[model samples]
Every structure is written in C-alpha cells, then in structure tokens.
Target chain A: MTARPKLVLENVSMTFQSDGKPFTALAPVDLEIPAGKFISLIGPSGCGKSTIFNIVAGLQPPSTGRVLIDGEDATGLIGRVGYMLQKDLLLPWRNVLDNVALGMEIRGVSMKEARARAMPLLERYGLGGFEYRYPGSLSGGMRQRAALLRTLLVDQDVVLLDEPFGALDAQTKSRMQEWLLQLFNDFGRTVVFVTHDVEEAVFLSDEIYVMASRPGRVIEKLPVDLPRPRDRAIVSTPRFVAMKKYCLDLLHMAEPADDLAA
Target chain B: MATKTTSLPPTRSLFTVLSLFGASDDKGRPIRKLPVRTLWSNWIIALVQLSILVTIVAGWELGATFGLIDKFFWSQPSAIFKTGVIFFTEGDAFTDIAFTFRSTLFGFFLGTTSGALLGMSFWWSRNYARIVQPYVICLESMPKLALAPLIIMVFGMGLASKVAIATALTLVVSTLTAWSGVQAVDRDQEKLFYSLGASRFQVFSKLIIPACIPWIISILRVNIGLALTGAIVGEFVSSQHGLGRTIIYAGQTYEIALVWVAVFVLSALSMVMYAAVAWLETVLRKGINQ
Candidate 1:
C-alpha cells in the first residue's frame, strides 16, 4: 500500500468580506505533500500565496475545506506547523538565544531545558557569540538566520516558509537557499515554500505549483528533475534555464487570465 | 610675473571674540551652544550648570544685602540656607519628610499597580473597555486636587487622605497611557505567539506585558510627580506634618526664609524620586534584554 501523504488539503478555499462585499481570495483547491518533500507555490502578487501559508499555519480558518496531517483531519489547528514569514518577525526585546528558545518554552519546555537545547544550535547556525545580543543589534542576514532557527526549534514535521529569502540581497539569498537545502535534508521535514521568483521556485522545489490570482487557483504543477546536491552552478545549466523559461511562460499566461478575471 | 602684494590679517569681529566662551563655532555665527558634547565634557557642563545656580543665589543675596529687594518679602538665599539647616537639625522637618514620602510611596504603588491591572483587563475585554473609556476620559480631565476636601473627609487628615489624593491624581493617566501601550503592541508579534500555540495568558505574560514595559516605565515616571502633587495638595488642605503644611504655616507667619527652605526640600524630593524611577527603568530594561 502507498504511504499516506504527510500533509493534505482537501478543497481548501478562502473568501474575505471587502467593504461589505464578498471577495473571493482563493478558489477551492486540493494539495498533497509527501513526507520529506520540498514543494513551492509560485504566483504573482494578490494570488493568495500568503493566504495558503496562513491557512496551513492555522492563523486563519479556511472558508471551506479540511486540512489533514498524516491522514488525520486537523483543520484549523495551530502550532502543529512551523511557519517563517518574509519578514524575520523576531521579538525585539528577546536576545537571540531567548528568541530561539521561545517556541520550545511555549510548548511547555522549562526555560533551563529550552536554553540548553538552543545553545548548540546557536553555534551550529553561526549565531554563537551573538546569542546574547538583541535582534535590533543584528544585521539583516543574522536576524533572518535567528528567525529560521526559531522556526526550526519548534520541532514541527511540516515547515511552511513564505518567501523566507525574498528580502535578502542576491548573494545572501543564494547563500541562504543553499543553507536551507542542507538544513532541510538533515532534518528530513516536509516543506511548503511560497515565492514569486520563478528561478527560486525551480531551484529550491521538488515540485512547483504555479498559481494565478483573481480568485487564486493552481494552474500547473511543474516537477524539477534536477539532480541531488544541486549547487549555484546548476542555476546556469541548460536544463535549469529551460525549466525557468517554462515557468516564466506559465506565469505570463497566468497574468492575462488574471486580467480577464479582474 | 605675479605682484608681491601683502594680504592684511582679517579683523576679528565682536561676535568672534564672544565665541571663545563656547557660544559659537569658528564661523562667527550667533550660535547657542547647549552645554552638551560640542565644547565641554559632561562634568564641565554640570559645573557650568552649577555656576549658573550659584550666580542666581549670589544675585539674590546681593540684592537683599543692598536693599534693592526687601529681605522681609523676598528672603535672602543665605537666610534660607540657614533656615534649612535649623529645620533639619532642630525642627520636626525629618518627621514631615518621612510622612510625605510614605504617603507618596503608598499612592504611587496603589495607583500604578491598579492602573496597570485595569489597563490589561480592559485590553483583554473589549466590551468593558468600550463601556469604561468615556468615564476614564472624563475623570482624567477633572482636577483631582478639587476633591481634596472630599478625600480628607473620607480618609481623615492623616496619611490615608494624602495617599488617596495621590492615587486619584495618578490612576487615570497611568491607566490610559498603559492601555494605549497594550493597544500599540505589534500585531505581527501577537500573531507569531498565537501561531505558536500560546494560550491567551501566555501571550499576555510573554508578549503584551514585556511589550508594554517602556510605556509602563514612562507612566511610572509621570505618576511619581502626580502622586507627589496629590500628597502636597492633601497636606495643604489639612495636615499636621509635611513640607506643604510647613510652607503654608511659614507663609501665614511671614517666615519667607522658612518657606524658601521648605520649597527647596520639596524640589530635592522630586529630583530624588525621578532618579529612582530612571534607575528602575534601566534595571528593568537590562532584565528584559538578558
């Protein structure tokens, strides 16, 4: 028998009330993510990409449908999935170590135990000496790393990353992407990444779901056949370029369809 | 072939000479130097401030000695200082100081604790907040000192009355300020905590309370002055001991020097209270960061 998917969304949809009028943000959609797979949702602005992350993170209940974790119905359940938004969202008052330990503490871990668990990760994540420093004092890259560490320390099986590297400079973004790949591989957790960058979608995803706005819906599923242990050089390869071009074309097609819907 | 013409030295303007006293830059513009980092060390700035105070006191003494001002109406600085020495050494000044300090402390603690708790409760319950907001605004606008007689009648002419008045003066402002702070907590941070499976109480303790600390400290600073004002006002209405009562008695008996001494003591008390709050803020912030 085939193993059950790690996460499943059965006919999830969202509609918001805008100025007393019904505004559909997302059409009913279904998604299945296998255990330990890296999936990405690529779309334009207003495509409800973030809405999906919010739903998965259980920040908002979907207007329709159910969420399942390991085939167990878990709709509207929060704190079961780790989510890292585009902004680091680090608590300014907390030092780097304390911030990283926050999730564990919330999960009923003692402060001493949480700190002990967080201690090794700080050095591993290259935040060792700066652990005692406030978020305000850290650089953009360091702050994002600390945020990612916070998300990871939560010990969730499914991690939802909403354009996690979107705000970084090109060099930092590329570096973080590689670091995330290794981290995910080591952790073996299923990840659902959302991004507007087609190249980023192609580079990081095992499968990319192309979405269109104006009542957001998945239009295509493009699987990346790139070899394992992909590097920066893979991005310039012919196969990688071809896949990127195909996604760009799909996105361009999605725009006209969005306009028609508008 | 260049002509060997000699250039004359530039004439120094009057303003240029004045700038040597750290009033302006080399440009000779009429600049107002604040006694900050530009021209002096911090200690030097403090010394300059001290010099200004000494000058004022010297002027007052000279004016009284030369009969430019009546020593009877406007007391001499030296006489006031002598009166201050006597008040501390021989008079019941220590008892009055202790009484006023105790009243202010009691009011400050009661007002701040109740205000913070009420503010957090209001934040927790929007319906209650909506119902009470108008009343809070109205009470805040009312001059608390006007209720001195009522407070005295209720609590009696003792420490309780002074504390009650101080609490009245402090409560409304602290409540409103703290409520605004709670409201101003970053929405994203709240969502983060919620998404982490934090209960309402956990969110409050971990996020809201820590987030509202700076505002609470600011309110504490403000409440200190207000509490003192309440205590002094309560004493003025009816009290056997306190700097306020002493001032009133001195004024009635035409003891201008004694009045000046009491006023100086009150000023010192305010400064010490303010410094204590500032120290508390530093300690609290350090704890948060750690």
Candidate 2:
C-alpha cells in the first residue's frame, strides 16, 4: 500500500468540437496504477478508454487534467510511457529484427548495435530464425508477438497496450492471452491494457477499470484479487465466470441512463 | 447428385482458377501454391498473343494486295517491314533512336528523382503540404503538352527542349502519386513513431520514407510512358533527330512506309523500356516483401 504509483491520472477530462458543437468526450477521471502491476481498462465504445490511453501515452493533452509518471507532472509530454496500438504496425520494409529495434533506432542507436541488442530478445521469445524475415511473411500471431516485443523493447517502465490482441482469432487470442501473462510476469512492467473483452480483462488484469460511456468516465475500479501466473483453464472456473458476469452487469447498468438522456 | 454437379464447377477449370487465387485445403489452410509462373503456362499465353499479331498483319497484307485497302494511305505490312529493314541497316535511324532514347531516360530519371524528393519533403511540414499541394494539383491538371511549343522556343529546338518537355510531363505526376502515398500512411503507424519520441526529421526519414517506397516505386511504371510521350511531343514541336522527328518528316514527305516503320520502332522501344521498369518493380517488391 505504501509503494509509489508508477502512473497517475488526476481529474483527466477531454472535450472536442465536433462540427462546431461542443462535445464532452471524457468526464473528469482519476486513476493510479501501482508499480509492476497489470491494470486493464474495459469498457464499451465511446467510453474514452482509448482517449485515456492517448493521454497517458502523451499523444494528446486532456482538456482538464494532468498525468504523472514516476510522480512527475508529465502532462502531454511524449515518450514517457511505451505505447502499442491494436495494429502490429511493423514497418513492411524492415525485417523482424530491425522492426523490433525501431524505437531504439529512432533514438540514434546505430543499426548494427540495435540489431545486436534486438537479436537476443528475438531468440528468447522464440523468434530466432525469423529475425531476417519480413513482416509480410509472418503469421498473424507472430506479427503481434513481434509488435509486443517492439513495445517491450521500448524499455519504458510503464507500457500502454490498446486492444493489442483484438484482431486475432479466438484460439490465437486465448493462446496469446496466456503467453502475454507469462511475458508480463517475466518483465514486471506496469501495463495498462484497454480491451472490450471481459474474459480477457479478468484473465490478465490485477485491477480492472470499468468505464461508462455517453459522458465517458471511470465508474468502477474493481480489483480481480485473483492468483498471479493465471492459466487459460481459469476462464472456465466459477470465480472467473462470476467476475466476468459482474463486469457485464456493470456495463449493462451503465446503459439505461443514456436511454433516459436520449 | 444433380444438385452437386450443378453447384460445383468442372474440376479442371475450377482447379485452375483456385490455383490463381490461392487454394485452401480441406481443413481451411492455404496450400503451398503450385508454381503459377511456370514457363510452359506463360508460353501458352505468349502463343495466343503472337497469333493475334500474326492474324492482324496477315489480314493487313491480304487487304492491301487485293486493293481492298489504300496502299498509299495505309502502307502495306511488307513495305513497312522492308522500310524498317533499310532504316535500321543504312539510314540515320540509329541517331534518331538514340536521341529519343536519351531524352526519355534522362527525363524519367530526373523527373522521378526530383518529384519523389519534393513529395517526400512534404511530409516534413503540414503547412508546407497545405500551401503547396493545391499548386501541384493545378500543375497536374495543366496539359503540359500544350507548353511543348513554348518549351521548344525557350529551349531552342535541341535535345534540351525535348528533355525539358519530358521532365515537365513526368514531374507533376510522380509528385502527386508519391504525395498520395505519403498521405495514405497508416495513422496508427505514425502514432507509434511519435510515441517513441521520434523527431520530425526522424519520422520523415525513418517512417515516412521507407513506408512510402512501395508507393513511390509504383509511380515508376506510370511515369515511364509519360516521359516517352513528352519526348515525342518535344520532337514533334521541333528537334534535330528522334523517332518523333522521323515520323513527322516521313508524314510531310508522304512516305507512308517510313512513317509506319518509325512508329513500329518507337512502339518496340517503348515496350522494352516499360518491361525493364516493370521488372524493376517486381524485383523491388520481392526484396521488400521478403
């Protein structure tokens, strides 16, 4: 309880003018993620979940709030936290090794040195032979792995992943979820994941932030309180089912107020 | 049995189409593609294409011999062929062909290089792109061929004017095509680069440049023909020697066979250049896609 939070968002709100009409996209929200813990933001569409990510990633400024990284008021400042989107975004012209080394390369690491640094990660993560192959030749699952490796290699203490596995098929998604939990345990980085899948949020997250839409804000922050190093078999367990059910119910209950407003 | 037979295509024909599109196995996995580019298959297509050419030439010859076609206006194939032999063997065809070839190649190299660089530089500043893009569009819409006469006047009826005209025709198109490619870069990819603390120059050089390379290479195929047309147009306006000059000279003298011979040689030369660029595109594609 006394540990310093790795990332903090205080009263973050976002508004925009859509067609000259003032639109409130995110209501004032507060969040604190502890160091080395996995946090997940799960919500319906238009829930400002990604807006928070953009804020945390330092891509956009919140209209009314501040973000703190390692207790610094790092608001709207870029490169504080590593960021990954839903797409694997590997540069098609570069091979896997070079793609994984992209963030470092951009920071002025010599290509030879970057490749040297990236080779071990590729081998450790089971991509040894594929370091020279291009992204076009890799399978969908492999591409995402390479993307995740790229984000990991950014070496930021806090990593933001926005629906990284949303595009994968069911079997691949489940497999990747388990594999991701392993990587998370190994790296021990603070991860804030955004996703629409309730099972996924429950399986990987230590605490889940369930957001509400219309006037988007974090309504409930529920801690999973499950055991660490969880397995895929837990998805079928009664406790996991109940947590998933509670999330669905919370999501459903947030919908009626929109009906009233409409 | 009747329904199945009606629903399914004949096995061999379906197999061929499926092979072209990439056939999947019974378990929905893509199969190792049968080599679609075997020489034997291409040879069959080549054979059919050759037959079409042969049929056209044979019909033209027969029509000219029977006096069904005007030999004076549309020179007979044999006469054109004979003229082509003489032109290549003994006339100044070498000089003219080389002149046109040099202008086309220089214009192609210069236009694509300059235009692609201009297009790429647009990625550096939003204000620059916004201010400059409208002018690019206006230039693209302008019929540069109409300016060939003025170009000839200014450039003084030499290879310089022809090269200038060719460059004008190709430059704007490469800029526009490459600019569109720059614009079409995946937004998410750009965001990824930004999140990595990429400087504006880093984003331009690292992400924007290589990512748009396929788009830039694709324009090479289009610009080659435009360059050729520009060269020909410049020659028509005024030039010392070129295929374009040969055609215009033959037309004025009413030597129909020489005109046809020059036309045929120009078409053959253009085809060769087109094929070379196409092969480059494929090689680059393979390298990028590896």
Candidate 3:
C-alpha cells in the first residue's frame, strides 16, 4: 500500500454548456492519489465529485487539467480505467456472470475465458451459484456486489466508485462498507469512492475529501488513522465518531445531534 | 364480477389438481376425475353460450328462408357456407386467395424491411434523422389510397400495384415503431454498455437491440393486420384478381353470397396471420428473457 501516486489530477476543471449558458461544475483542482489506497469524496448534491471522477475515468474531458498516471501523461487511458456508477447499471437481460464478464468481452477475450475468470470472483464474493440469475432477480445489496465484481473483473488498477451503495438499505449499507474494506485490503487496489454519507466516508476510506456545493471544489481533506481490517463495530469507537463529526462539520450538513456515528 | 366469484368455488379444486397434471383449460374446463359435478356445470355454462350462437344463426337462416328479409341483399350463413365449400373444393376461390396472399405478403416484407432499416439508420445519425424526418412525416400523413390509381397506372394493373399499396402502409408504421423503440431504451443501460468498454457499434448491437425487441415484436404483430388491410384496399382500388376483386365482381352481378364469402375469407386470413405473429412474439420474448 506504499506505492507512488498511481493517478494525479493537476489543475483539473470542468465546464458544461447547459441551455446555451456555460456552467462551471468544477473549479481548478489539484490532487494526487497513491496506489492501493481507498479515498472518499463527500459533498452536497450537484457538487463536482462525480465530475472529477468522470474526468479521471476518461468518460469526460476536463476543461483544463492534465491527468497523469505513474508519472506519465495519461492523455489516452480510457479502457485502462474501471468505473462503477451510482446506479447498479447492470444489464437486466444479462445473467450475473455475463454482466461481470462484459468488460472482457469488449476487450476481445473469448466468451469461455471471460466466464472462467468471472465465475470464481462471483463465488468468492458471496455470489456463488447465483451466476445464472438475471439482475432483476437480485436484491439491491446483491446487485451492488455484482456491480463491484464487474468493475473488478476488468482487472484495472484504478477504480472509480460513485456512491455504489447509495441505493441500499441502512443495515445493508453498513455490511457492504465492512465487506468492501476487507476486499480492498485484500486486493490492494487504488480506489476513489464518492458518497454523500459522512460516516461512510470515514468508515471505508483512508482519506476523506469534503467538498462544497455550487462550482464544486475540494475544501478539506481528512485522514482516517484507523487500523486495517475494519469491522461494523468500528463505528462505535470514539475516533470513528470524531472523524465523522469533523467531516459533517466540514460539509455543514444540518442533522439531529446523535452519536450513531460512534 | 359476481358470476366470476360464484363460479370459482366449484372449480377451484379441479383447477388445483389439473394444474399439477400440466393440463391447460381453453374453454375454461379440463377433465377432473373427482370434480365430476364441477365438470358437468362447466359443460352447462358452455352449452348456454353455444345455444345463444345457435339461436342467432337459426333466426338468420329462418328469416332468409321465409323471405321475411331480402336474401338477395344480404345472404344467409348457409349461402355463405355453400360459397365457402365451392371455394375450398372447386379451387376457384383458392386462386383468388393465393393471388391476394402473395401480393400482400410481398408488400409486407418490402415495407417492414425498408422501414426498419431506415429507422435504425436515422437513429444512428442525427443528421440523417433531421434530413429525412420531414419527408417521412409528409408521406405518412398523405392519403395513401389516392396514390393507388397512379401506382396502378405506373406499375400496371398487376400484382405489383397491390403489393406497392400494402408496402406503403406497412413501411410507415414499421419506421415509426423502430425509431420510437430505439429512443425508449434506458440511458443507464447505454452507460452500462459503455463502461464495459463496448465500442459504439457493440453498444447499439447488444444493449439497444435487446431492449427494443419487445417493442419491435409488438409493432410486427400490429403490422400483420395492417398488411392485410392494405392488400384488400389495394385490390378494391385496382386489381384484375383476388378476394377484393371477387367482392367487386359479385357485387356487380348481385351475387350477395359470393361477396360475403370473400369478406369472410379475408377476415379468416387476417386472423390466421395475427395468431402466427402472436405465437412468434411469445417465443421471441421467452428466448430474450431467458
């Protein structure tokens, strides 16, 4: 987990033409993410966390910024980057195994080989024997797991997850966070996760970037110093509560004063 | 609704047992060994419906036989049935039916294929959509029957004119359906395909096609009926042979029974085509969902 910065966004900015008017979604920003680290970007709605993630994934061009990968200019790294959107976005017609193998299929891997690689991950990730089921049959949590496996099956080093559990039930969301932290620790993959939930940012990420609304820019970066192999009980710890408070205060989100973050 | 409730209690047991045995009730009844009383009641209900139909037919036959109504103006069912017998046995009506069937089917094929291809092409390129969309609108809005005489004059009063008319009707419907189907696909689905590293062509081929198939199949089922109408209309306007021409010929000779026979044949053909398309749609949906 101590590798050099795998992805660096230098002075990245985004502007969109909405109804013939220029709307700046993200102001100029600079960030560097090291390899094998889990980073969360938390912000209000319409904040540019998604815009920034999209730019990094090569899905959209930054108005002004240079994205570098491994100290080299990454002007063309579209296929090399893996992304999971807020929506599960699973193809309803496709079975779980095929959905996960879609990335390989596009990369020209034969069907047999793609399935062989995707099936094991499905089984290992608590989706065993459910490979043949369609997306419509899976619950929200199961679907999100299938989606993560899809992103992982692409075998890309840098993964962008945009509120992957935003649509889950509260209990399921907590379980998923612990599960993801364990998986991240095992795989040692660099991840940039975006979420509106402050406690989730503190629970799953090593560093949390709190963003402000309207022309979204990163205002604060808080580091979580928790030990590895985090579990659900970590939320009850004093440090976890303190870190979540700091993030909530930074975002200025109004809420009932509760120690649930603890 | 009240009838449905009263009927349910008696048949419930029979249905449960028959369902396990893999039997389907079409006339709303299946053989049940233990539910003999329920089975007899089911037959009673069927008999009542059958009696209603028989009474109506009997009254119609009696009126024509007794000259209570002018049989020369509107023939009886028996007269129509007699004409149908001649049609099947003498081979005279078969030739006419075959003529109309061939022309209409050809037109249907031409219209649907061209329409679907054009619709897909338009969807793929906005520039093409912009350019050709107005022309399509004008063509679709135009009264197509007015063009039939000119079509006959140009293509000659042969099978081609009938085919052209049918094609004209079918093509518009197909194009519109295909375009709307393509547009109705979920945006998230498209993004899903793209994130999988699918190229533009692959996205269109895999995601777009599969999502729109149900819509396309529904359009096809509708087009089958439209194709038959188009063919009949074409035959009525200008054709030397076919069911439409036979109707015209019978009307001129005051042979009302023959005209009624042609009408029934046309309707029966449409019904058959509709059934076939419905069966195909079911099979296709099963395969896609699976």
* TM-score for each model: 0.89, 0.86, 0.87
What C-alpha lDDT does candidate 3 achieve relative to the native structure?
A: 0.83
**What DockQ, on C-alphas, does every prediction get?**
0.56, 0.59, 0.34
Local lDDT at B137 for model 1: 94
Tens digits of per-residue lDDT for model 3 on B1-290?
56554443577677667778866566546655565443457889899999999998899899999998789897898988988798779846878889888887888788888888777667577888999989988988998877888888888888988888889888988888788888887776676666656788988777777777776777877777777777787788778889998888889999898898998898888788788878988998877777
Model 1 C-alpha lDDT per residue in residues A26-57, reported as the tens digit of each score: 99989999998899999888888989888888
Ranking by lDDT: 2, 1, 3
Tens-digit lDDT string for candidate 2 (A113-215) = 9889899989988688999999989989899999999888878999999999999999999888888888898899999999999989999999999998988
- Give the clashing pairs for model 3: A235-A262, A236-A262
Native-contact recovery for every candidate? 0.60, 0.83, 0.32
Scored against the true structure, residue A163 in model 3 reaches a CA lDDT of 93
Question: What tens digits encode model 2's per-residue C-alpha lDDT throughout B1-290?
Answer: 55554565446656566767787676545578466774668889999999999999999999999999999999899999899899989999999999999999999999998998898888878999999999999998999999999999999988899889989988998898778888999888899999988888888888888777888899998999999999998999898899999999999999999999999899999999999999999999888787
Real A-B contacts recovered, model 1: 0.60
DockQ (0 to 1) for model 1: 0.56
Q: Please tell me how candidate 2 rates in CAPRI terms.
A: medium
CA-RMSD of model 3: 10.1
Model 3 error, position B84 (Å)? 2.1
Off by over 4 Å in 2: A236-239, A257-262, B1-72, B75-82
Best by DockQ: 2
